[model samples]
Target: MSDWLDEIHWNSDGLVPAIAQDPTSGRILMMAWMNRESLALTAAEGRAVYWSRSRNRLWRKGEESGHVQRVIELRLDCDADVVVLQVEQLGGIACHTGRESCFYRVLRDGQWATVDPVIKDPQAIYAGGHGHD
Candidate 1:
């Protein structure tokens, strides 16, 4: 039998874009990259796991912040290149900036506008100091 991972059309870097969505609010929380191991771990663990390109390692969501995403469902786009995860975002935070989502900025009058307010102080969220995505 073919492996389920084989069905995904990974990019040249062997990574696929994964989007995390709030299952209840239907709001997009954040997006991350996933490699085969990270994707498999997410399914097996029933939580969100992603490949940290900057850290060059498997990043278990909320490992540092205690804001884990409990994945309820996983879907693949028609082209089988993108993945979406319906998740219950713990602690009501998803962005490293302590915002509800990474998409807090909107294009307004050709300028980026910050709409969503930071739910928590990033300094309180990250003990080692913020700036992680």
Candidate 2:
């Protein structure tokens, strides 16, 4: 039943790195992991669903913060070990840090610096300690 998933070269831990990107801007938002169930659910739901390694369960994007990603397309890398999800990020937020994307830091002077301003306060986005896994 999961023949499509079997084609993916999952790591020894049974996980594949999944990247979420903005379809319009072609910007990489964040990187995550997906298991067979999550990957299948994402395809069936037309949304991004990731396997939360920290929580050891399925994590649906925007479930905690209302920044759900509507998947536009799903692509597999040449190695078949990585997945790229082209999506329209709802509410324009994809990071738990209240940033548009998780990759808001830039390497400068051999140091990491935040280049983007927080669109909203993370405290307001997440009601409790559920901000990060």
Candidate 3:
């Protein structure tokens, strides 16, 4: 297992893409970047942790929204370039836009379309809160 960890092909940015999926439903929830620390934290804590490139810090998924993802399984591709996390999502909506998944937009014939409606209001979920901000 340690050898597998060492074999992960992190790029020059020292980051790799991690895909989060719903374990029960087999639905892909979201995709985020993970550095080595984030990967270690996620594996140790059994929760999804990601490296926030914009903020230049580690972020726990759903920390602000109360939509934490509990990881059930972590998988690496044959090439060890990408990781897939099977998780049990705590919140119904995994997306900041109030959708179940971040992939709310679908590309159709050279256009992007919003296929899924917002499941819940983000403001309502994080009312008077400071997590996302």
Clashes of each: 0, 0, 0
User: Largest TM-score belongs to which candidate?
Assistant: 1
The per-residue C-alpha lDDT of model 2 at residue 8 equals 98
- RMSD of each candidate? 0.9, 1.5, 2.0
lDDT for model 3 comes to: 0.88
Q: Which 10 consecutive positions of candidate 2 have the poorest summed lDDT?
A: 124-133
Whole-model lDDT, model 1:
0.95
All candidates' lDDT scores? 0.95, 0.92, 0.88
Give the TM-scores of the predictions, in the order they appear: 0.97, 0.95, 0.90
Clashing pairs in 1: none
How many angstroms is residue 56 displaced in model 2 relative to the true structure, after the best TM-score fit? 0.6
**Which TM-score value belongs to model 3?**
0.90
Pairs of colliding residues, candidate 2:
none
Q: Give the CA lDDT, 0 to 100, for residue 45 in model 3.
A: 98
lDDT of 2 by residue, 27-71 (tens): 899999999999999999999999998889999999988889999
Residue 14 lDDT, candidate 3, scale 0-100? 95
